[model samples]
Target: MNFSYELIEKYKETKGYTQDKQVISDFEEFNSGNMSKIKKGTRHLTANQCIEMANAVGMDQKEALLKLAIEKSKSKEEGKIWSDIVKKISAACIAGILAAASLTGQVVTPHLRYRR
Candidate 1:
């Protein structure tokens, strides 16, 4: 949910030309007056806003959205991979500990005993 101010600024500079002032103003007006208040600590960007901003910044909205989506998906995939690796390592460690305990005849219970 990282917000890239650099990307926003770059888009603004490219699209906020003199001739595009009216469009930019319209966008600002729409955002400030009509769009719902954004909640804190949330990463939510309206599709219309993205399109408008992209239009203002001389970039394709679909491309920007696609890039953002791809980045998010990649991060999620990486996290899942890391989580899987951690689970495997934890399981292996537990298995090793159990094996060591068995080798040392560390049986747990008053009712049962290790014959070997």
Candidate 2:
């Protein structure tokens, strides 16, 4: 899915990987053929691979997985439902940060990371 591709791309970008093979080599479970297939959108990554990439890119694992679910929805109606969930999850995370920051007398900004 596109979300998986983005996670993989983000991981590669952060690691300074110049080619798909570099990423393939980095993961013991990955092979050049599969990596190429994934990059070309002919194949999908396993959940573990997605989690690994999410970690490498400093993304929240739950959000990354939710995004993958959104992309994997079987129908437009289902995808819309997933998309709404992701939006609510993201908003809740931000709201929680703001609430905590308020209690601590600190200003929370949109660009700030709640985790990390």
Candidate 3:
């Protein structure tokens, strides 16, 4: 993941206007500790740490996290919807079988439903 100093600066500018001292304190603490330890000088933003800092700055961490979550949810919902469709098709097939059996003058008892 790419770290944008411009973006961070923009977020800082936006977030700095707030009355939240805790955020500024946390940013200072992170800069003094973890951020300072990275030797790559500004090129060391990992995906996880970006997420952490985004949260610290009161930015849209949920929106970023929800990217993956939304995709997973969409996939799950799509699978479920198609599974229900398949189930409906299977039920239609069963109904067709029962109709065929009835038309053949056979005694379509409830026990015959077990054939499905």
Q: Which ten residues in a row have the lowest lDDT in candidate 2?
A: 107-116
- Model 2 segments beyond 4 Å from truth? 107-116
lDDT of each: 0.53, 0.81, 0.50
* Model 1: residues with Cα > 4 Å off, grouped in runs: 1-4, 15-41, 71-75, 78-116
Top TM-score: which candidate number? 2
Each candidate's number of clashing pairs is: 1, 0, 0
Using lDDT as the yardstick, the better of models 1 and 2 is 2
TM-score of each: 0.35, 0.75, 0.29
Question: How good is model 1 by TM-score?
Answer: 0.35
Supply the TM-score for candidate 3: 0.29
lDDT of 2 by residue, 20-69 (tens): 88888878988988877766776777778888888888988887888777
lDDT assessment of candidate 1: 0.53
Question: How accurate locally is residue 9 in candidate 1, as Cα lDDT from 0 to 100?
Answer: 51
